[model samples]
Target: MSLPDRKEAEVRRMLDVPHPAVPPDLAARAAERGRRILVRRRAVQAVAWALLLAAVAAFAVWAAVVEPWVVPPADTTPPLDGW
Candidate 1:
């Protein structure tokens, strides 16, 4: 048989067998694990947001103090006027 037909027949043969018994506490365990994963993900997200805010605040403070956008004064003086 062709590869696709052979794969399909194999899948059908596997599906025909009886399935294994599931653990009684499977749902509870899954729910608890999911809750823990969700909590960890949320905690990480919160920390990331806090760090972003902190970085923004620091940049704001730096910009306020430094005023980097303003042009600097010329270093050399003009020639003496009315000499």
Candidate 2:
């Protein structure tokens, strides 16, 4: 085949190939899926933040409300008579 004829044949073959048509609801379905994913992601983030906040609050409450240190009584040993 001549170069021009080969090129024409290639073009014709490409043009003749049928493209699959997208469904009418494809965009809507995709948008709905994306929204669901985003909602789930946001919910997870919110729960994580809530848990973290609760932990911090609990620690703060423990630190403020509970005095955990113990003080020893005064030492009773007598001073030495001579240095």
Candidate 3:
């Protein structure tokens, strides 16, 4: 048989076999695990947002106190002030 025909025959043979029985509580168990994962994801997102906000507030406070935009005073005096 050709390669494609052999592959098709194999797939047909596999499909003819009976599928295994699933557990009755499989859906419920999967749903419970999904809910737990969602709760954890939401909690992590909330903490991340809170930390981002706190960082922005801290930077604002630091900038206000330090005033980085203003020029600093010169170190040496001019030479001809007295004459």
Candidate 4:
């Protein structure tokens, strides 16, 4: 019983050991990577927006010149009048 308790205590102590702190340069590198990711994201977003605007402009041009939409003339009287 005593031997098992001693081993258990030793295992608990080993598990509680403090981990080494991260190096100062590691934090700077992480910040630099984050900035790069942000820049890439912004660039991708700008390209996506430009593509969307171009598609909208193309659709508008198509609707205006190639496939023109015309409204039918209104009927003078109602279709159903009496019960």
Most TM-score-accurate candidate: 3
Candidate 3 vs 4: which has more lDDT: 3
Per-residue accuracy of model 2 over 1-83 as CA lDDT, tens digit each: 99999999999999899978989999999999999999999999999999999999999899777755656667898788979
Which whole-number lDDT from 0 to 100 does residue 7 have in model 2?
Answer: 100
For all predicted structures, in order, the TM-scores are 0.79, 0.57, 0.87, 0.61
What is the lDDT for 38 in model 4?
100
9-43, model 1: which lDDT tens digit per residue? 99999999999999999999999999999999999
lDDT of 1: 0.99
Comparing candidate 1 with candidate 2, which one achieves the higher TM-score? 1
lDDT of 2: 0.92
Model-by-model lDDT, in order? 0.99, 0.92, 0.98, 0.91
Write the residue-wise lDDT of candidate 4 on 1-83 in tens digits.
Answer: 59999999999999899977889799899999999999999999999999999999999999988656677568786688687
The per-residue C-alpha lDDT of model 2 at residue 56 equals 100
Clashes of each: 0, 0, 0, 0
TM-score of 1: 0.79
Better of 2 and 4 by TM-score: 4
Once superposed on the true structure, which residue ranges of model 1 sit more than 4 Å away at CA?
1-5, 79-83
Best by lDDT: 1
Rank ordering of all candidates by lDDT, starting from the highest: 1, 3, 2, 4
